[model samples]
Target: MSIHSYQTALVTGASSGIGAACVRMLSRHDMRVTAMDRDSDRLAELASETGCEAIVMDIRQTEELYETFADRDIDVLVNNAGLAHGLAEGFLGTGNDQVDEMIGVNVTAAIHVLRAVLPSMITRKRGHIIAMGSIASLYPLGLPVYGASKGAIRSLSRHLRMELSGTKIRHTEICPGRTETGFFDTAFGDPQQRASFVSEIRLLDPADIADAIEYALRTPLHVNVSSIEITPVDQVPGGQILG
Candidate 1:
């Protein structure tokens, strides 16, 4: 898909997985891409491979984040940096630090980045904001905290779209089901546990979601795709409630 409409884009969590895929796809479309991630090495590699600018910094660092993109005239903002402790851990089991980290990165960080970039878009009166949500947010899930974070994203996207009504700016939420990424490593820690959890379920690749983002961005300025939920063909959410 051609992103000729957009001249520049900023993608968070761009070192790997869906974020990295977005960097590659946007670059292919000839958009000037700014890839951001905490991993300096991986960010450099991605920049080299895709010919995009790299910002090696944690999204949680609000001050630095603002400074990094101060002079950038971004046309698209992809909020994709997020993490979870594990499905087995309930809200209390996850502890304070992990909970803070999840909220900080998933919700707060996105807000900060938007705050920095939206002014430019509003001034230009044209831009697209793509947020990465999860199917877990759509239904009651075992991963309570993670689901809540994504749910916040859903609400944020909806409200932002409403606030930007009658303007050229657009907001879209891409909610994806199980995707193969390092998320499992951070959540489960042990390799065996991660394998066992995903062993039975069909996992979607990062590229799949990246393709969805491309489609959303490629749509005409008059067309706004509000939200899209994508899941692996073999995996479906169960509706039964266990007592």
Candidate 2:
């Protein structure tokens, strides 16, 4: 697709991190983006920097998602909002609250958002949906909920593509390995753990993932890149814990 082929895009989690990166990259291509996130200030900052519209939204609230996108014509929908909480205490030790939160945000919320936007895309016969899954999706990790949530997204991406087979809509799943982000510190809840986990390899900059997103969106309308797995050159393909 040409840089200007897509006039507008809707990106969830478009405040900081990967979502913010995507907004910045897409704006450079001159696409009008509807950037939404829970962080109103950061979302505003992103919009100001990218010349895109910003809306403060929490995807966990399915009704709010519908209200936000009801009247919009979206050319691309990037489902990128998600979270991970370590279940180091064992399955029950992980606690039901954390599990519910992950499922609500990663799996349930994604379906609601997709359902709300897909009809318009189908009616218009033009759109692309990209989900930000993780390398953990390919194989289960010790963090059961985190891996399973992403696993759901990975499968959702494929099934969506199959369902939209003959339509102009396209679905792409991006599975990126560990990166230098607040995710490690926040998820693990230990600064020391963050260092231990990430010290093995250089991290991929958020801009790199953003570039991949832009590329997938910019691919010619006829050529749909269904899936992408990107990691640092030093990063292994699977099981980051392997010796």
Candidate 3:
């Protein structure tokens, strides 16, 4: 679909997967896109391929993040930078470092990005904010820390909907289940383990998740598509829990 509303966009964790797909989609529709990620090589490759402005930096660097976007009036903010670690180990069994990394990148840095862009959006009185979330956040699952991080996203989206009431700004959270991305690689940290985990189901593609984001952005200016949870038909996320 062609985009008529948004002019400039910033997508975080944009070197690959859902983030990269989003950059491609937005750039395809002629939106000026800024793709940010710590992977300089991949980020440059994507920029070369898509002609998107690439900012190579770790999302955890709060000072640099704020400075880089100070002059940008981003129409669409994709707060998609996130990761999961020690998922197979679960929370209690996971390393403290893994816990910190997940929270730092997913929740803390996301807020910083939002703070940096929102002041301008508030002044302009228009913008669309999209937070990358997961189905794990909405239900009981094996992931404790990772799920908690995304759950915070779920709450943030709700609050944005409440706080941005008449500012003409929009908040939408895209929650996808089992997408084929480097996310699994980072989450499992082992190729064989990651493969086995995903082998049973037909995983959703990064572009499929991007399609959901596009749909939300394509809606009428007055219509705010609050949240979308897209999953592969083969993937179901529930089981009985009785004490």
RMSD of each: 1.9, 2.0, 2.1
Per-residue lDDT of 189 in model 3: 69
Clash number for candidate 2: 3
Identify the runs in model 2 with alpha carbons over 4 angstroms from their true place.
1-4, 87-90, 237-243
How do the predictions measure up, each by TM-score?
Answer: 0.95, 0.93, 0.96
Each model's C-alpha lDDT? 0.87, 0.82, 0.90
Estimate candidate 2's RMSD in Å: 2.0
Q: How would you encode candidate 3's per-residue C-alpha lDDT over 1-243 as one tens digit per residue?
A: 457567899999999999999999999889999999999999999999999999989999999989988888999999999999986777777789889999999999999999999999999998999999998898777888999999999998898889899999989998888888888888886688888987767889999999999999989998999999898887777763210
Candidate 3, number of clashes: 0
Clashing residue pairs, backbone N/CA/C < 3 A, model 3: none
lDDT at residue 194 of model 2 (Cα atoms): 66
The best candidate by TM-score is 3
User: Which regions of candidate 3 deviate over 4 angstroms?
Assistant: 239-243
| Tens-digit lDDT track of model 2 for 26-129 | 78777888888888888877877888898887788888788877887888888888888873454566768988988998899989989988888999898999
Pairs in steric clash, model 1: none
Global CA lDDT computed for model 2: 0.82
